[model samples]
Target: MSDFGLGVSGLAAMFALMILRMPVGMAMLAVGYFGIVIMNGDRSANALLVTEAFSATANYSLTVIPLFILMGNIASATGFSRRLYEAAFAWVGGLRGGLASASIVGCAAFSAVSGSSVATAVTIGKVALPEMKRFGYSDALATGSIAAGGTLGFLIPPSTGFVLYAILTEESIGQLFMAGILPGLLLTALFMITVTLVTLRNPEAGPRGAAVSWPERMRAVLRAAPLLAIILTSIGGIYFGVFTPVEAAGIGAGLIILMALVMGKLPWGVLTDAVLDTVRTTAMLYLIIIGASVLNPFLALTQVPATLGEGLTSLGLGPYGVLLAIVVIYLLLGMFMDGLAMLVVTIPIFFPIMTGLGFDPIWFGVVAVILIEMGMITPPVGLNVFVVKSVAKDVPMSTIFRGVLPFWFAMAACLLLIVVFPQIAVMIPQAMFR
Candidate 1:
């Protein structure tokens, strides 16, 4: 068979394995290994696999992932995440749908430390849902807000999505982090607007919360000061060039641990669980990276990415038209594929085409992350929606999905704004570098 045909078959096999409930890394690894054997020989494939596995695990920059994750896990365990919501609530809870708005605010704050979308959703949802319910907020609004807000985890600084994007594309991690900030804040604002519109139309849906006294608001903010300071210091440090991402993550995680210890919040058992969870998550990410490494080499041998890029460029569509087409394809695949899976599998094929078309890699990274995040709240297989359902058990999946639709459109709007004014994504990074 032709090399291109062989590549197509390998992809089909990988998808088949994934559909059969095999782990994503194993599926990619299995396809990559045998494809290499077919195209070359057993010895070549063995060497590739061994080298990739070792290099992926040994990479120093990846240490940031575990450290950021540990910081988030410790915050969740010690109730620091809860205080973020409390602080936001004291300030905004008096507004219509304010509790839900505070959830988005809390998610945005927590996302600075926690890069995982599911973790952000789960942590914020658990705290916000119960309180919103007590306030007689609509299920659609309450559940929808948390599910949508959780997506900020993927678009914000310290994002795992951007990290994987940087790794796959070999772009600067700091630039990608900078690119994400404006877009993240923009999306957060859009989400809050959606909540305001929903509550405004149905005034009964999100009632005005009792006004908090200025003294209580200050007190609440004070209570959340430590985590807030950590968020500012870590992200601000990266912006000011005071620390690299790995260094920032290490310092942030260490500070959180020390705070928990001093406050007597970290029990021996909780610390053990948090450490074990971090290891488990780090292992899974490493496996996925190794699988992508092996698969990329095999795909290169088959010339699939090059062929795909040629095909995309040959279509008479100008650059913007081609970009729209890529966006549509991402949306369709995102309906069924998990966000990270979509990133690792598709970037190898699409990244070259985009750069050839003259799109800024950093700007595209922000757009791509936002698009994938929208999928996390999109229907038929929305991961964050399911997380919301898990937290709000009595609420049907349908309600959560319905609630998420408005926020999904809000994300779409945010994506459009960033595209029309590409500088929004690039400005922060450019200023930082200059």
Candidate 2:
């Protein structure tokens, strides 16, 4: 069989294993190992496996993953996430669909700390859902806000999506982190606007809550200020070149821990659990990275990317046309595949094509992550929807999916805007790097 044929078969086998409930990392590893052994030799495959696993685990840069995860876990354990929600609610809860809008804002804030969509959804959902419910917020709007807002976790800074993208593509993690800031804020605003339009269409869908006094609003902001300050200091330090990404992660994690301790929030039990959660999440991420590392070399040996790139180039679809096609493919895949799985599997194939077409890698990373975020809320396998469902168990799955539709379009619009004005994604990175 041709190298291309073998590569295609390897992908098929990997997907089959995944369908049969194999862990993504193991599936990729199994297929990649055997493919390499067939094309190269057992000695080569054995060496590759050992070196790749050790290199992936021991890379100093990867320490950012556990540190950032620890920061997020500690934030959640200390109840800092709830304070963010309260602050947003205090400011926005009296307006039309205010609770829903507040959920979006709160999710965005929490996402700055917790880079996992499910974490953002579960953490903010617990706080916002009950309040929205108390205020007679429609289940669809209430749940939809939480589900859609949770996706900001992947787009905002301190994003694991961007971190993983950086690791895979050899792009600057700092640049990718900067690239996401403007687009992330833009998407957050668009989601809030969706909430407004939905409430406007059906006033009963989201009723206004009692207004907060200016003093109360100030107090709420004060209460949430420390967490926001941590986000800005950490992310901003990276953008300004004051710290490397790893240093920023360390500083952020350390500060969060210090603040928790100072506030008497970091009891021994909570601290231990947060560290354990960080270890578990980090291990999962490293496994996937190591798997991708193995699979990437196998794909390289098969020359599938070269063949695919040349084939697409021959079709005479210009860069944007091919780019659009790839985006559509990601959208379709998003309906079924896990977002991280989609990234690990496809970036090996698509990243080269994207860069070859002269698209900026930082911009593409931002765009790709946005597409992944959309998938998190897309139907069928919309992970965030199920997360919100877990939190709002009484709400039907269908209702939660229904609620996220408008925000889904809002995301699409955000994607289109970034495409048209690539500067929306790249401008910050360029300015910072320049």
Q: How high is each candidate's TM-score? A: 0.98, 0.99
RMSD for each of the candidates: 0.9, 0.9
Cα displacement (angstroms), candidate 2, residue 253, comes to 0.7
Error at 275, model 1, angstroms: 0.5
Candidate 2 runs further than 4 Å off: none
Residue 69 local lDDT, model 1: 96
Candidate 2's residue-wise lDDT over 1-434, tens digit each?
Answer: 99999999999999999889898898899999999999999999999999999987888878788988899999999999899999998999999999999999999998888888889999999999999999999999999999999999999988999988988988888888888899989999999999999999999999998999999999999999999999999998998899999999999999999999999999999999998988888888888999999999999999998898899888999999999889999999999888899998888799999999999888889889999999999989998999999999899999999999999999999999999999999899889978
lDDT by candidate, in order shown: 0.92, 0.92
